[model samples]
Each structure stands twice: as structure tokens, then as C-alpha cells.
Target: FNFLGYNVNVNSLLANPYCKYTECCNDDWIKFRRNRLMRNLTNHVYGQPLLQHAVDALTSHFNPNFQNHKALVLSFHGMTGTGKNYVSNFIADSLYINGVKSKYVHHFIGRLHFPDESKIPQYKEYLYNNLKAAIKDCPRQLFIFDEVDKTPPEVLNSIKPMVDYRDDVDGVNYSEAVFIFLSNIGADVIREHFHDLYFEKGRQREDLQMIDFEFLIQKGAFNEKGGLFHGDIIANSLIDHYIPFLPLQEEHVKKCILNEFQIRNVNLPKPEHVEHVLKFVEWGPDESLLFAKTGCKRLSSKVALLVDKYYRHESRIHNEL
Candidate 1:
């Protein structure tokens, strides 16, 4: 008998003298839940049209009949605290069964993994070998490179073959693998573009299209004097998409604080207390800038401090009464 493209010897198993029952094993559906991923992304990620494109790319790549590219390559670029890392976490959690803890997922930090420029060659070999070995074990693997701007250019170029379309490498087909690169490079360009569209051009933030920011970011990353500089990944168009993450505004920061409060199970009777917490968060260098410089990176700690202060104030009042 045949089951789901697999040949099964049902008669042999049934005729076995000691066999009591027969069982069949088939391939597991390793893709993520689309609706769950989309919902979670919408709830967490704010004001970035690139995120929607990311969702579409992921969906298309995971489709069983997709034949365009052998691998999915995504480059996430933006300012710090702008949900770049957050979105990466969301993708991992939504796709893999074990989330970030999955053995099929691999993470590498640029500074931590390859800090010394002198070791670029060694790092490149190591990266290729590790990826080859990992994909050999499981083809449906996800690899994330954080702080990619800090990585050496040579090191970044080493993985071009893996990200590009190819039949096989040493009898191992890695077409099913996914690669994500996160960087703070080209942040200024993104910020400038946002300012131009919203402030100068009188364009609404909601009306901004993915095309508005995509090309400019690609131009910045490819031409910028950094790790991704002079790399064929961008030059040869190996990257499927360059996703830009926008800076967080005050309102968005407030929402983040509220979300943090809910996660920590802290209840504040007065909504004004949330505003009080905002005071603790420092702004960017330029006072003219409306967006938070560090983004929500420091908001959680500030929120904690404010909550502590609020509780202490309550305690003192009760004691006096």
C-alpha cells in the first residue's frame, strides 16, 4: 500500500506472527501557524508596513508549492529599540515548535561571535561549516544574525552561496533554510525618510508604503561603509527583502509601557501614573526629534522604577494615615 507518497508494506507487517497492530509514520508539517503569527505581529509591532511584507514573504516561502527561491533571506534594518529584535523573536516563536529554543534555529551575534577583524577568514570558514552541518541534520533551519553591522564584511560575504539559489552543497540541499540579518546600520536614512514623508511631504504615517522605505534602506546598506559593504548579497540581489523598522513615538512607547505593566501584572488606578513613568525615559540627543532615541530599550527599566516609586508613595501615605 502507498500512503502520502510513501510506500508501505502493510501485508508484511500484518502477516508478522508477533505483530498485534500496525503503525505508520509520515513527514511533519514544520511550518508556523499564519493566523497566530499575523495576530501576534499586529499586536506587538506598531507602525511598520515592512512587517506586513515580512509576513507575506514568510507565508510565500513556507508555501508547499513555492519554487521561486531556494532559501528565504531577510535583512532587517532600523534604529535601536525600534522592534527589530522584537520582530525577530516573534518570527522564531511563531514558526518553530520550540520557538527560540528549537534546535533547528541558530543565532549569532556579530560582536560576540566575530569581534576581531583579523579573524574574518577563520570566522567565515566556521560560519559556513556550522551552517552546512546544521542544515545537514535538518533542512528546515532558521539562522539569525544580530548586530550584523558590527560583523566583518568578509564574514558577511562568506554565506552568500547558502543564501543564494543553488541545487546542493556537498550533497546537502539547504533550499529550505531561512536567514535573517538584523542591523542598526542605515538608521539615519530611515529616520530621515520618515521625517520627509510625514513632516515635510505632509504624508500620513498610515499611508506610507513599503516601497517608500525599501529602496532607500537598500541603498544605504549597500553603499554604507560597514559590514555589509561591498557584499554580493546585496549587489547580486540575493536578499529577498530589506525590512525597515520605524522609530517608536511617545504614544507607541506608552502602549509598550502598558503592555509591560500587563505582563508584570501591575495595576495602577490612575492613568496619569503611566505618564509619570514616561518622564524616566530619556529622549534622543536632539530635542527637536519626536521619536525616542533608544526606542523602548530603556522603557521597561524606567517603568519598573516608576512602579516602585508609586508603591513606596502609597506605603508612606498608609503609614501616615
Candidate 2:
């Protein structure tokens, strides 16, 4: 079946979705495994200290009873490749057995799904029906909206019925669902805030709290002509947490390169090899903390170049023998 640009399979997931709504079967799909998600997020996601708050929010929302009054709405604000999507995937992996690919998980990119701003009316109706249907079919649903900044403001109101403070919209409770909105709206604000905390204020970035940033990103999002701009999504206070994702600095970039090496199953890169990847990365904001311009966006390609060169050199030495 086709639902919101994704193909849905009505196999075990649909026919027997009993495990999703309860703890009886002990199955993994949409089961809130707090410790597993926490461990993975702690280990895999790099340079995102704010994620600590996210962890707190998630754990609290998904208590033992797993009773949420409304959909757990997390609005992620950051630049591209700053672990926004990565963290979202980790969340999916933690909650669902099949992760992002699970029929329960519905990821929509604004640019791809609702590209034409003029068609906001049509997009709104289409999204409204899909979301309502998905929630009814499987309450343990995860809806990730990527590139949210590109989606029309009117189109987002389609989400109001699901995220609002209501027990049920015609008997379907949205409390068991999740809605993640990812954007690059307030990345610079976060970067500047971090710089002040680290340098002028001489405070540790680690010491910063959600209170310091939660509002800044929200304000930026409201002011910016993007996802949350003039939308009831913010005015009505539908978003639970305005999680700010900071831009990656040099140290984090180095870590990303090393992490990328491990991901590719390549040899542990030597110091020089790591430096080579660093050299290709552009860093600035000039006179500031010098965070990566693209925040590890093109890192995979750069790491690939190093890996290919290493293999080629190894082959030459083997042939020499």
C-alpha cells in the first residue's frame, strides 16, 4: 500500500501489531528501550552536548507505562550534517526494531514531498489524511520531517490535530506517536551562543543547559521565514522541546573523520591521514570558534579519498614483493 510517498507492507508488522501497543510480546518494534537508545546516542553521536537534554526528555516521555498525553514533538534546530539526522536515526533504532525502514517510521523531507509552496493546500490535506490513517493503524508511529524549513508554513498546521493537547481525535490517541522536525534554522545562533560560553564567558560548553538555548532557537525559528515561521505549530505551543543542535568544531570534525574511518571498516587512520581529511574541511565564522562550515556534511567523500589512496598504496607494495 502507498502512504505518503512510502510503500507500506502489511506483513507481521501490520497484521500483528499487538506488540507495538503493549509489553506482552516483548518484541522490539516500537518498544521504548531506553537504555539501548541512550547507549547508542552516547557512543555514536559526536559533539552534541545538548543531546543530554534530549535524552532526558525522551526517557521522561517514554516512561514504563509509556503514557504520553500527546505526541512527543521534538523540533531539532541545527545546520546540515551536525548529527540532526544521525540522532533522529538513533531514536528510530532505539524505538523500532526495523529502525528508519520500519513501516511504523514515516520520514518526510519538505523539499521532496512538499516542494511547491503554491500547493500548500493540497499538501496539507494529503499529509493530514496519511498521518491520521497511520496513527489509527499503528499508534506506535514515528514521523520524521526533514528539511522542515522548506515546507510551507500552512502545510505544518496539518500536524496540529495530532500534536495538540487532546485525549483523542475521534478515538485515535496520538500520545503513542512521535513527530520530529529537523531544520537548519538556528544553527548560527547556536554557534554564536557556544562561542560566547566557551570564550568570552569562559564557561564550558559541557556546562550549558537547555534553558540557555531552548528559547534562542525557538525565537530564531519564529523569526526566520522557514518551518516554524508564523505557523500555529509554534504559536499554539505544539512543539514539546525546541532542541538546539550546535555546529561541529575542529575537534568534532577530527572525531567525525576517525568515526567515518571506522564506519567504512577501513584501517585505523594514521595521524597524517586524519590531518589530510582535516585539510580538506573548511572552518570559520572568522574570529570565532572556527566550526566546520558544512559541519561534517561532505566528510564521507573526503574519508573515502583517503581510504582509496591507502588501498592503492598497499596494492603497489604487495606487487613490488
Candidate 3:
């Protein structure tokens, strides 16, 4: 069969592990550079001072000297547009050659994949079998589960055993494997905590640490009405870190606007261009210590409108979408 202009055997491809993980293993293979990932985070990602901790967690977990005690589990909690999904994809891009599209990366959405609560039993079986095969094939596989708060506890049961702190699970070692769970369960709490610290207590954003918001996230995940809180994953302390993403401010939005304009390579955006885009953004926290309601999620569309209105003089190629 011809795949991407190369003839290949489908059976042989499936039989082998998905890209054995290092250049030394295969000269043509992609490798992970700790510096590259750190640089990407430092340059592309904005706001969220707590984000710095992720650099250490990811690098240390994937280190070659690390033991195969169990899989690396990271639970990301925050509001929309807070870089949860963005950071998740960055991790994939940093780890695998094909980035998020890599065959080794498996992404699942709770609402879409599971859906019917009544079918959770079957879903559990299906999830288990799929994961078992993938992990057996490549212990370094990456699994991303989005909308975890919407997923039911019974459905999440499928992943508990594989991610647990067991050295050998039926002869399979998942030390190099990674599991990322993204959810909006603790958005309100995180924002409120930040607001109170900055406004009520007169504490600066830079001074706040993970401890300030972590307990709130833990409280939400444990008490919230979602699959994340319903299971023993938290009680058993299976998750490595509960990474929190705070709300984005107007300055951060301005930076995103500038970055987007730069990426398009059309007419350069001016001060007015940024001001025009900011009008469309929703700010909250009662106008005191304002934060973006949707973070950077709506910037792309708003910027598209900005370009169409003013920069339409610049011709776009037919192939450009």
C-alpha cells in the first residue's frame, strides 16, 4: 500500500511500536529536546505564572534515568482559553515527531466518545481493550482525555488500573506512558482565588504560588459533579500534578493579538488594530482585576474579522483557507 507516497506493509507497521522514541534508536526518528520545549513555553505561552512548574514535571518524568514505576498522569484544571489544550498539544509536539497528529498520540473527549451513560459498561470494556493494545505495543503512548468533568466515573474506570502506581501490570510496564486529563471543573475557584488574593488581600500575582490555588482545585475535583471527582484517582493520589491555569488579562490578550497578526504576514497590526480587537473580548471579575472571559479562544475569529475589515486589500492565495 502507498502511504504518504511511500509503499509499506500495513501489518508490519501495526505490529511494531510507534516510532521507538529516540534518534539513537532510529536515525530518521524525531527526538525530544528539553530546551526546545522550555523555549516554546517561555515564548508562545503567556500569563499563568504557575505554568513554570510544568517544565520541571514533564522533563523529569520523561528523563531516561526515571524508573518505570507507573505512568505519568497530569490533570489540568482551569477555565476556557487558559492554555489547557494548548499546553497539552505543546507536550505532544515536544514529545513526538508528528506532534499531536502522531499515531502514538490518542485523544478522547468524554462527551463525544462516551456520551450515553447507560452504555458506560461497554465503554469501559472498549476503552480497556483499546488502551491495553496501545500500551502493549508502545509503552510510551500518550493519551489525552478532554472534558473529563463531563465523563462519568464508571466510564473512567477503564484507565485507573493502567495509570496506577504498579510496577508490572500483567507484564506491561507503563513508566514512559503519559496521561493528560483536561477539565473546567475548577475554573471558577481558581479565578475567584486569584481575584481575592490580588484585590481583597492585596497580594501580587507574582507572589502567589501553586499552594494558593491547588487546594481549591483539589476541593473542586473531589466535590464536583464529574467523573474526575467520582473515582479514587484522587483519594489514591494517582495523579502526579493538578496543574492550574489562571485567567488571561488584557495585556496577555494584546500579546496574543500581536502574535496572531505577525503569523498572518499581511499588513502589520497597529495600536488601533489591537484596540479594535479588544472591544470584542469579554472581561470579567466585575471590572476589578479584569480577566478574559474566554481567554484566547475568541481571538482568532476576532482577528480574522479585523483583517477582513481593514487588511482585505492584501490578496490571499486561493489555496489559503
lDDT of each: 0.80, 0.83, 0.81
Greater-lDDT candidate between 2 and 3? 2
Misplaced by over 4 Å in model 2 are 1-28, 287-289, 312-321
Task: Arrange candidates by TM-score, descending.
Answer: 2, 3, 1
By the lDDT metric, which is better: model 1 or model 2? 2
Candidate 2 residue lDDT tens string, 1-321: 888998887665565566556532235555777788889977777778788777788788878666678888999998777888999999988887777777888989989999997888899989988998988887878899998888888899888888998999878898878899999998889888888887789977677789989889888988898867988989998899988888788888888888888766655678998998888887778755378888888988888777777765654555576
Each candidate structure's TM-score, on Cα atoms with residue i matched to residue i, is 0.86, 0.87, 0.86
lDDT score, candidate 3, position 138: 67
- lDDT tens digits, residue span 1-321, model 1: 888999998866666554233211112325666787898888877767668888898899878786645789999999898888788888888776567777777899998999998888899999999999988877888899998888888898888888878888778887888899999878999998888788899998778888998889999998887778878788888888899888778888888888766544564525887887777666764876588887877767766666566665654555576
Residue 218 in candidate 3, Cα distance off native in Å? 1.1
Error of 1 at 306 (Å): 3.7
Give lDDT tens digits, candidate 3, residues 29-89: 4356678777878888888778777767877886778675788888999889989999888
Best by lDDT: 2
Residue 233 Cα positional deviation in candidate 2, in Å, after optimal superposition: 0.8
